[model samples]
Target: MQGLARGIVVLGVMLAGVQAAHAQPIKSPQDQACRDEARARVFSTPDPQGVGPYVIGRQIYMACMQRASHRASVPHRRAAKRVKRAKRAKHR
Candidate 1:
């Protein structure tokens, strides 16, 4: 009876955990490229976590991502920067 009860509890916990487990797919080409670059850089560099010198793959990835993000927002920034002039010739 105790063994059966434990099995039921484990099954219940696993079922509950299914909802929380999820994977986010890469959303853009820039993101995919960044990931590829990071993977390659990390592999080529010495593994600090394993041996010695730290890898700068993460830095490469982040810089690329930030640049891409900034480029994507440029249009919106330009729009926000310009305000339309209002004419009051009628009042004059």
Candidate 2:
């Protein structure tokens, strides 16, 4: 009886977690591109047997996202130029 009750509680918690969790929509076109590429790369290969393909695809997606984040974090060229000019000129 106790085991069954614990199982029921675990099931309820799992369901609640799944219901509460949501995907963070990617805002940039670059992220969308990464997702599209990941999907294509993952789905292009036929794996009718095991979960290897899905796992590999997830790794690829993570790597792509890492790259996208790096690229997005870089400041614009105009902003960089302004900073350089400011650094060169010291106000009295």
Candidate 3:
């Protein structure tokens, strides 16, 4: 009976961990605006390279997207750190 109880507890803890890890990070409004602006800028410009305008536009859009995304995800990163610290404290 004790063994069974221990197994169930372990399973519950594992599921909780999985749920936490799978939770989606919330996107900030600024991130959305940044992406929208990048999209518009890329689409509005003519292909300067001429050989492959889309490729150049795509590169520019992606660079903008990454920078904005990284900035916007700062809160998520901080929350993750807090979670990690809490878990460490719990274990100790």
CA lDDT of each prediction against the hidden true structure: 0.71, 0.80, 0.72
Per-candidate total of colliding backbone pairs = 0, 0, 0
Better of 1 and 3 by TM-score: 1
Q: Please give, for residues 1-92, the per-residue lDDT of candidate 1 as tens digits.
A: 99999999999999878755632478889989887877777667666556432237667778889988988877765454443212344345
lDDT of 3 at 62: 70
TM per candidate? 0.38, 0.44, 0.31
Residue-level lDDT for 79 in candidate 2:
90
Residues 12-62 of candidate 2 have per-residue lDDT tens digits of: 999988777744578888778877887789967666666787576776778
**lDDT, model 3, position 7:** 100
lDDT of 2: 0.80
Better of 1 and 3 by lDDT: 3
The CA lDDT at 6 in model 3 is 100
Off by over 4 Å in 1: 1-24, 43-55, 76-92
Q: Distance from true position, residue 90, model 1, in Å?
A: 23
Highest lDDT: which candidate?
A: 2
